[model samples]
Structure formats: C-alpha cells, structure tokens
Target: MNRSTNFVLAQILFVILLLTACSTEKTASDSEPKKKEPKKETVEKAPTEPEEMVKQGAGEHYEKVKDLEGDDLDKEIKELTKDFPKDMKSEDAYNRIIAAFAADHQLAFQELEDFDITFEEVEAYEKYSEEDGEEKKEGPLNVVILLDASGSMAGKVSGTDKMTAAKEALKKFAGGLPKDANVLLRVYGHKGSNDDKDKKLSCESTEVMYPLGAYDAGAFQQSLSKFKPTGWTPLAASIEAAEKDLQGKEGNNVVYIVSDGIETCDGNPIEAAKKLHKSNIQAKVNIIGFDVDNEGQQQLKAVAEAGGGEFQSVSSQKELFDEVESNWSKAMHDARINWSLSMDSSSVNWSSSGKGHSMRKVYSKMLDSISDEFELLRSVKMELYNQKKMTNEELDKLDKLIFSRYEKLREYSTNKHDAKQAALDKETDRVLKLIDENAENARVE
Candidate 1:
C-alpha cells in the first residue's frame, strides 16, 4: 500500500513541473518588444500665395484731388479734412492739400489799440525821464543826410526834375535844423554819366561832401549845386559810409535818406540799414522816397522797418516839407519833454491805454484758425507719408508753405504791437507837453 501511494505522488509532481514550464515560455513571448516598420518620407506640397492686400479708398480720393483746381480744390480739401480719420493713410494726402490751401489763404491784418491816457506810477515816469535825460544831455546833435543823385532823379515830375525838387527840399530842411545840430551831407551817384560805359564809375561814386560838423549854409548850398543827377544808385554803399561818418559823434543822431528808386548797384541797402541800426551810434533813420514807384516803395519800406525808422513817400516839394516839418516838430517836442522831465521832479505822472480790444479779439481768432489749420496739415502730411502717397519733394513744398504762413502771422503780430506802442507813445508825449506848458505858465505867474 505504501509503494502504490509513493508512485501516484511522483506522477502528480511530474505533471505540475510540465505545466510550470509551459507558463514560463508563454510569459517570455509576451514580454519581448516587437520591431516597428520605418515611416515613409513626407512630400510637403508648395505653399499657396497669401490673400491680396486690401487697399483703403486712398486711390479714389487721390484721383478726386487731382481733378480739382483753385477754389474748387480748396473747397474740396476743406470738406474732405473736416471729418478726416485720425489714423487713416488717405487723411495724410488730404492734410497736405489743405495745408497748402490754408497757407495760400493766410491774410495779414493789423489791430491798432487806442492810446492809454493815465499814468501807472510816478516811478515809471522817473525811470523813463532818467533814461531820456541820459540820452538828451550827453550826445551832440548829429544829422547826416543821404541824398540820392541816381539817373532816375533826373526824370521830370510835376514839371520839375526830381533832383531839383529834392535839392530844394534838402536846402529848406538844412536851414530849419537847430543851430546846435552838426550837419553832414553825403551824396551818392553824383559822378559818371548814366551811360552803360560809365556804370563802373557810377557804382563807385559815394562821397561825404560835408563832414559831420557845423557847415556854412552857403558852402552846403554850393556843394549841392556841384552835383547833377547822373550815374547808378549806390544806396547801400552810401549808408555804409554814413555809419563811418557818424562814428564817435555824440547825442541824438538822425539819418535821412532821400532816394528815387531801389538800389541799382547790387548792394543790399536793407542789410546796410540793419548794420547801422545795430551799431554803437544808435542812430534813427528816416527814409524819404522822392516820387518812388510801388516796387521801390515796398523795398524802401522794408529797409526803414529793419532800421527801426519811418518811411515816407512824397511826390511834390510841399509833401516833402510837410513830412519833414512834422517829423522835426515831433523830434523837437520829444527833446524838450526829455529835458524838462529830467529837470523837474514835481511833474505829475501819466499812463497810456489801448482802444482796440475788440479788434485784438478778431485778430486772435484769425491766428487761432491759422494755427489749427497748420496742425491739421502737419498731421495729414505724416499720414500721407505712411501711406506712401507723398514723395519727399512734395512734403518739402508743404513744409515751406507752412513756414511762410507762420512767418506772416509773426510779422503781422509785430506790426500790430508796434502800432499800438507808437499810438501810446504819441499820447504820452501830448500829455507831457501839456504838463510842461502848464509848468512854464506857473513859473511865469
């Protein structure tokens, strides 16, 4: 019974071992990694073109602008820019056009204020009197007359040669001058004939016939008689020479230039005047255009302004005398006032005011309009540049127009300011004169 049991157990053990070997072989087969197949090379098709860039309505507006001219162009530009987009490229083109239009339309107008009639403070008068006294008492009364003897002066006006009328006017002016004032007569274009052959010699003819000092009336008259109307105008050269003549002369220098036309010797009289004004002499220039035409008047006006002086146009001897007398009377009054104010401390103080507040407002509005237009143009120009519609050359033209408009505004402002100041000064002078006359009467009493 023991042997049979042991045999059965051995058989069962062998069956268990065969089952374990089969399970091990199956696990090994499941755990091993499988080999992957190689991937096929990808063939990328060529990229399709991007969608066409969409353009704004710049081309359409540009075409519209090109077809317009004058008022129509201006009106259209104004209408287009009225509601223009801030960031739109086509807006730039509109701005450029509008800027040019505004520049062309810029008009200069002056607003003059009424003179102030009340004094601010006694101290102000005292200060002004002190400065006036310093100028009045220290310098010698020096007067230099620049007489033009250009060929044009020989032409007849009102049945008399302009040169003869000019000389007669000068003689009267010289005679009326205060005895204390030192006189100098400088004549230009007095040498050489008006012929083209004599051009070189005429251009070089600028001489101080009478030096800056006391002169005999007869001698001065003779000097005037010596020269006849001949040669080209050397106006600029004559003024430059006058600067040297006045050098080292003290007190109250006045320069009077009598000319028939603009500079014919290619010299810049305006520049010469500017140099003389800025010099240490501190002279005041007064220009008399002796029957000068419109073009000549314009140029002479610029010279007078630049020289800090006044310009007067005269066609006859009577007109010349009137202007000269008026100027002299004013000068004499100013001198007397300065002297009196300096001597007397008991005089009452006076002040000045303006009368053009309403006009000034109008002027301000106009200036604001210009400024607004300029800013709009500037913005538009930049926009157009970004849009590539404006070339550099075209932008430069716009820039010049903008600059010109700005300059015009500035000049207008300056002129208005000067006019207002002059009016106030004249009123002040009137008041001072009254006070002076009253003081004299009191002293006489």
Candidate 2:
C-alpha cells in the first residue's frame, strides 16, 4: 500500500476500534442499574404553648364603699361580701378580678401556745414612779347611772335633755374610737309594767334597747320617752340579763347595773356573781349606788361580781354622762382592738423559712395593695364620721381618693409584663434545678 493510503486505512481501523470500545463501555454502564438515593431522616418534636400573662395586682376591690355611716336601723349591715368558687373559678379571671381582695393585709392568723390574747382596752395614764419610769395602769372604776323615764329624763340636762347627755357620751365614744374598740349600754327602770294580776312572779323591769351596733342617741331617747318606770325595780333580772349578753363580748366583760332602787326578781346578786365565776366567765362586776345608802352599795357590789361587770352610782346627769363616756371609751377601744387583731391575723400568711418567705413576699405585695385601699377607706371613714355626718362633697372626695389609688395600683399591675416574663424565666431555672437536684438525690439514694 502507498504511504498515504496505509495511513488512512490505519486511521479508519483506529477509529472503528475506538467506537466499538466506547459503545461497549457505554453499554456496560447503561446495563448496570442506577444506585438509589439514601432516604432522608426526620425528627419528632414536642408541642408547646406560651403561658398567659396577667397584671400583678389588677383586681377589683370595694369600689362603692365611701364615707358610709351607720344609721340606727341599718347599723348591722355595713360589711358583707361573697367569695369566688375554687374549682369552677378561672385562675386568670381570679388574678384579674379577685386576687387583690384575696391578698393578705399583714394580719397573721397563727398564735403561739399558752397565750390568751387579752382584749382589755387600757389607756396609759400618768402616775408617780419610784425606780423605773412613771408607772401607768388601768385604774379601777365602778359606775352606775339610773335612767329615769318617769317623765323626767325627757326634761333638759343643761338645755340638752338628760337623754341627750347620755347619747352625746355614746356618740362621742363611737367618734373617738381607736382602730380597735368595743362598748355596751343598758337602759332600765322604764315605764313598762312588769307586774299584773296574772304576772305574779314574772318581772322584767328593763328592755335591752340595742345589741352591739344598736346604740343611737335619737332612737334610745325616743324609746325612753315611750316607756315609763312602772313596777318595782327588777334589778336582779336586769343584771342577770346583762351577764348573759356580755358573755362573748368582754376583755374582762363587766356589768354596770343602773337601777333606781331595789331588786324585784328573786335572783340574788352575790349568788349570781359566784355562779358566773364558777361558769368560767372571768368577769369583774362593780356597782353604783344611785341615791342609795351603804346597804345599797353592798348589794350592788355583790351583784356586780355575780354578772361579771362593774357597778357605779351617779346621782345626777353630769356624773352619769362623764362616767358613761369614760367607761364606753375604754370598752370600745378594747373591743375594736380585739376585732382588728383578729381580722389582721386571719388575713395574713406568715412565713417561716426560705420557700415560705418567697410565698410571703408575693402575699406581702398583695397586702400592700390591700393596705392602700384600707388607708383610703379609713381616711374616708373618719371624714364621713365627722361633718355632722357624711355629705355628697365628702363622698366625692372619697371617690377621688379611691379612684386615684386604684388607678395607680392598676398601672403598677398592668406594667408587670416584664415581671411576669422574669418570673417565668426564674420558674424555668427553678424547675430545672429542682429536677437536677432530685435526680442527683435519687442517684445517691
């Protein structure tokens, strides 16, 4: 073959050989199955939702009570309210509407063993001292003033009737009451006949004018005018009745028997005192001999011990007014204090340890809100109590005070978003720590 023809023929043979090899390789590659892609893995996650946020102290309190005074008829209807049900009540709703009311007010309900909380309203008085500073003690007082309704007390005692003097003393006592106070008043020797042909032994000389919040000057005076001192002095029955009424209502519940003369009930005074003492009624009784002789004093003192109240004698309206005012003031103060302490204790949550302390801080914050309300309440109460009673102007002032305080409180509560978030963060940390600690303890155990 020529050189050119041999090169061409060589090239063609090389090309054919390359094409066959290429086809075989391509066929081999195509004949082999394609490798499958590896399956993608998936992860499951737990579902969760965010907790609801609430205002710290955003709850409704007494929005209506402002400068309210008690009339004689409606005196007992001052405080009343209903509480939310636990199971059915929504936590969010409670936090929004009732948490403030349920918050503590710094009052503690716990008591140490072996202590009888005394309910004595003793005002510190000036007295000469020896070694220590001046000594002050509750002075002993036994007083009694017979209210004469035999068409006499209706007359004036210094241009303001005898009844007026008594009522003024009572009103003053109510007005000048401390946060804690209690008092009692008994009217007797009225013009109601306890004696009749059929009523041989039945003798009820006096009527209990009012019980607890029933002390009103006008009503009492009106009652006196309507009734007259009829039959003999059923002093024993009156004293006995007073003793029963004073059972649950005394620091050292006492009796001040105001009688014109003698006892008609066969019930003996000294014997009754002994019986009352025997019944675990630690009461003191005193007597006031109203125009009575030494014999009368002896009888009164004996009866006073029986009923567990003191007794004193006042011949004129002046002495009566003064003594009543003094005694009532002391009694009322003591009673109110007892009530205040009780209320305080019942409403407060006491803390002892760390966890308790934290809980207490929460309660304390709540109480702070409550205290603000109470402060406004007390101020409004005082303002209303004065001013010949309450006026619309006074009411407006109270409303303003309450509204402003509430508004400030509401702002404080509403701005607790940051705090709530913080609390949640803290809680998360706490729960984690608790879980870790518990797990560690379990491992150790």
Candidate 3:
C-alpha cells in the first residue's frame, strides 16, 4: 500500500464511474431524511434525471413548442425526431413531440373560446325597444278608430250632442293608450248634407284623419277635430275605408266604429263589414251605436257580428266612456300575455342557442381533445423508444413533458367552461329583466 498502489486504484475507480454514467438509477435511501449516505461512493456528479430536465425547462420550453407552425414546425420536428439524441437533451425531446401535432392543440384551444349567447332569436326580445321621450315603435298591434261623422251623430245624448261626447271620450281613450301601440283615426260621411241630393257624396266620403303611428295626444286630438257630424251615415263605406288603411300592414289590427245608425245611402253594411273581417288584414270591427232606435241597434249589431266583433248600444254618455276604458284594459292584458308566451318558447330552446347546458358539451369536447393530444405525444415518444433512437433516460423525460401539457390544458378547459357559463347566465337574465320592465310599463293608466 504505497503511493504507486494508491494511484493505480484511483485510475480504475475513474473508469468504473465513466462506464456507469450511461445508466444511473436514483434510490430512495439518499432522499429519506433518516437515512445516511454512504461515504464509500465517489464525489462525481450523478447523471441528471429525465423528470428533472423537464421541470427545469418548463416555461420557455412550452412557449417554444406552442409557437412553432406550418412547414417550419414540420421540418424542425421531423429533423429532431429523425434520430433521437445520443445525449440527454430534454428541450429537443419536448419540441419534437409537442410540435408535431400543433394543429390539434390549436383546435383544442380554439374550442375553449366562449361563443356568444343571446336572445336575438326570440321575437318579442328582437322587437323590444324603449327610450324616454324618443319613440322606438315597431308595434305588433294597431288600433284604427273609424268615427261616423254623419248627420245622425249630431243627435243628442244626455243634453250633450252624440258627436261632442264621442269625440271627447275618444280623445281621452287615445291619450291613455300604451306608448308602444299605434293609433289610426279615420272619418267618413262628414263631407255632404243628410239630403237625398248629397247621398252619393256622403256614401263615398272616407278619409284618414290621423295616420297610423305612435299615439300622440296633441296630434290625435287635432285629427279628431278635423271632422264633424254633417252628412248621411255611410257605415259600410267607413269600415271598407279602414280595411284599405290597414291593407298591407302587419300585426294584430282592429277597427272600432262609433255610429248612431246602420248603413244609409243604400249601401250593404253587412256584406261590406264581412269582406273587411275576412280579408288579409283580419281586422275585428266593433261598433258603439249611441242614441239609436231599436231598428238601428239590431242592424248595427248584425254588421258588427259579421265583422267578427261585439256591438255595444249606449243611451247615455257614461256608457260610451266605460266602453273605451274597457278596451284599454284588454290591450294591456294581451301585451303581457304575448311577452310571456315569447319567453316560454325561447327557454325551450335555450340549452342549444342560449348556452344553458351547451357549455358542458363544449368542455367535454375540450377534454377529449386534450386526451388526444396526450396520446399523440406519447405515440411520438413510444416511436422513439421503439426504435431505441434515444437512451431510455431521454424518452422518459419526453413522457413527463407530455403529461405536463395534458394537466395544464385540462385546467384551462375547466376555467374557460366556468367563465363561459357565468357569462351566459348573466346575459340571459339581463334580457329577461328588460322584457319584464317593458311589459310592466305597458299599463298606461
């Protein structure tokens, strides 16, 4: 045991370490706090583990692999994986496996994006528009009032003339209509006198006093004043005029006629009223016969019945006022009902278009894509391992990188699903609330 003997033994130990450097396995004994490391082993640096190499080059490695695209990505991945590294290079292994299926990973990320969810498809929601002082009226219902300004309407009811009482009641009724509704006022038989000579002129008299539009108190009152009771009762002619006014107009339309008698001037009121009701407009024609005789009442009622509307006979001014008020109440009720029906129909299909449960489907697809990516990377790793291109250590490192990508993307998919679901709920509730507010304001008492 001299100096020569010590030098020869050290040289043999160095050769043993070099041979074992290619295959080193880590034992748990050195990792456990209670276990003491043996001093007989050499002070040489142990081979870096495959998992450690992956953890060390995590952030920058993932970014490099993610940015690679097109022919450049294809060339780099093919060249790196053509023959796996002879040396332990974790970066090359990550790039080769991860970059190969860039398009797949891109698609998975794209699915994670939240799509737009809205109530635009719902009819009521699509048509709803409200602003203070400025009208946004595309109303689904139009009310056309046909005033009979013939000589008989000049007759008396409660000492106040029929024409005066009717006009006053109508002006108040129109003023109280829901802001979203359109009002049209038409007058007939106001041009000629009640004489037989003016009969032809009176029968042909029909004019729109107030054009169809949003209810305006001032304009509507002015329109009502434009006509007076002066000519023969052209009841059939007035209703026909209303049908022409709403000829091509869309939505639920109605014609209300205030008359004191049946058709005069030899016109067929029943046939004319029937034709208006059955036309494309499908307008209901209600009649309010004020201060009329038994014969006039019976004939007026028949005309209304043929027109698919009710007839109300009134001898006093109070009856006229009450009837118009009833019409207003019914209009508000119908508006509420229409809105509720639209909401119910929309909710039935909300899962697909409104994203109620569709978010879960999107998330499920994202997870499947992540699994596909995980398996794809493993396939590349296995191909390298199957060929024995790289050492077992480098291939193990590539497996760690693939697992890392799977977990990161899985977390991302979950977060995106949660965020998207929240957004869908928020937007849906906002639209529903807006619908409620509009319906509530529709009551114009």
Q: What TM-score quantifies how close candidate 2 is to the native fold? A: 0.35
> Which prediction has more favorable TM-score, 1 or 2?
1
- lDDT to native, each model: 0.65, 0.43, 0.68
Against the correct fold, how does model 3 do in TM-score?
0.45
Query: For candidate 1, lDDT tens digit of each residue in 396-432?
Result: 6656755554556556555665666566567567656
Worst 10 residues of 2 by lDDT: 120-129
Model 1 bad stretches (over 4 Å): 1-136, 328-338, 341-430, 433-445
Candidate 2 C-alpha lDDT tens digits along 1-445 = 7999999999999999999999999999999999999886322221111111122222234333323334521231122222222222122222322332322322221111111222221111111112144323222221222342322344454556555555555455444544222335556545444545413333544566545343455654554444443444555555566667656543334444444345655657577666654554444555544444567666776676565555566656676666555544343323332322312222111101222333334444543554555454444334333422445454455445444445554454434423543454454454344334433222211
lDDT of model 1 at residue 307? Answer: 75
Q: Candidate 1: global Cα-lDDT?
A: 0.65
- Using lDDT as the measure, the top candidate is 3
Q: How accurate is candidate 2 locally (lDDT)?
A: 0.43
**Positional deviation of residue 382's Cα in model 1 after best superposition, in angstroms:** 51
| TM-score against native, each model | 0.52, 0.35, 0.45
**Location of the lowest summed lDDT over 10 successive residues in candidate 3:** 41-50
Q: Relative to the unseen true structure, what is the Cα RMSD of model 2? A: 30.8
Best by TM-score: 1
